[model samples]
Target: MFKTTVTPRFGDIDGLKHANNIAIAIWFEQARNPVFRLFTPDLDLSYENWKLIMARTEYDYVGEMFYGHDVEIISYISRIGNSSFVVTQEAWQNGTKGAIGRSTIVHYDFLNKKSEPIPDDIRKKLEEHLQNEDNSCK
Candidate 1:
């Protein structure tokens, strides 16, 4: 379930008088923990078992967000690859899309401590849940 709550923190704001970009990233990270939990408790286990790691991340700010405002962070899987998966996250305020972010995670091996391919079970879960409305059309 996607939970919605008001983010109240004075330090999250920056000199621009709005939520800093880093704060947005932290919010999205907090919001997406459920997805990882749903797939596996020891998310790190997969890297050792299959060799996956978080490869890249990007965020795009759409509207100004301030502290004390109710922020709703929606988390969803976007794309699943043979060795990686992309997670898409969006932050909203009063039903308006305020910011969007995506993270690409790859499988890695702890012994080697390097990037590797994603595991089968996790990939299957990502493929199953990453579906969106538009996916049905395709």
Candidate 2:
């Protein structure tokens, strides 16, 4: 699994003084930089070079997140398919799980405008961080 830390900013706080739901979503996406690097080593955004696209995303809030605390974001591949993979992530703050999320990313050919199968080399790398049924990397 890949882990990242996010420091909540004051602007992220809601009227209730808790981190806003939107902030969690942004944090989750930002924490995915490592995974994005797997497909684009240089983090290039050129249409021709970018090979992955976000197909879906969902999040469930389990607890409140307060500002001035660090949130640990853990991410791992939960499922791998021919043309797509699911990334499962968790947000933990103060030893409590604040949120859980899943993102489906598809490998696609921009020129062809169609989804493509993931390359073997990349697949092997992703397998290295694959999460097992018990929520541990294999």
TM-score of each: 0.78, 0.95
- For candidate 2, which ten residues in a row score worst on lDDT? 129-138
Where does candidate 2 stray beyond 4 Å? Answer: 133-138
Best by lDDT: 2
What is the per-residue lDDT of model 1 for residues 29-72, given as tens digits with 9 covering 90 to 100? Answer: 88867666644566555434534457899999989898778788
Backbone clash numbers for all candidates listed? 7, 0
Error of 2 at 103 (Å): 0.2
TM-score of 2: 0.95
Superposed model 1: Cα runs more than 4 Å off = 1-6, 42-52, 132-138
Q: Report how far residue 22 has shifted in candidate 2, in Å.
A: 0.8
Q: Can you write out model 2's per-residue Cα lDDT over 66-133, one digit (the tens) per residue?
A: 99989999999999999999999899998898889999999999999999999999999999989863
TM-score of candidate 1 on Cα atoms, chains taken together? 0.78
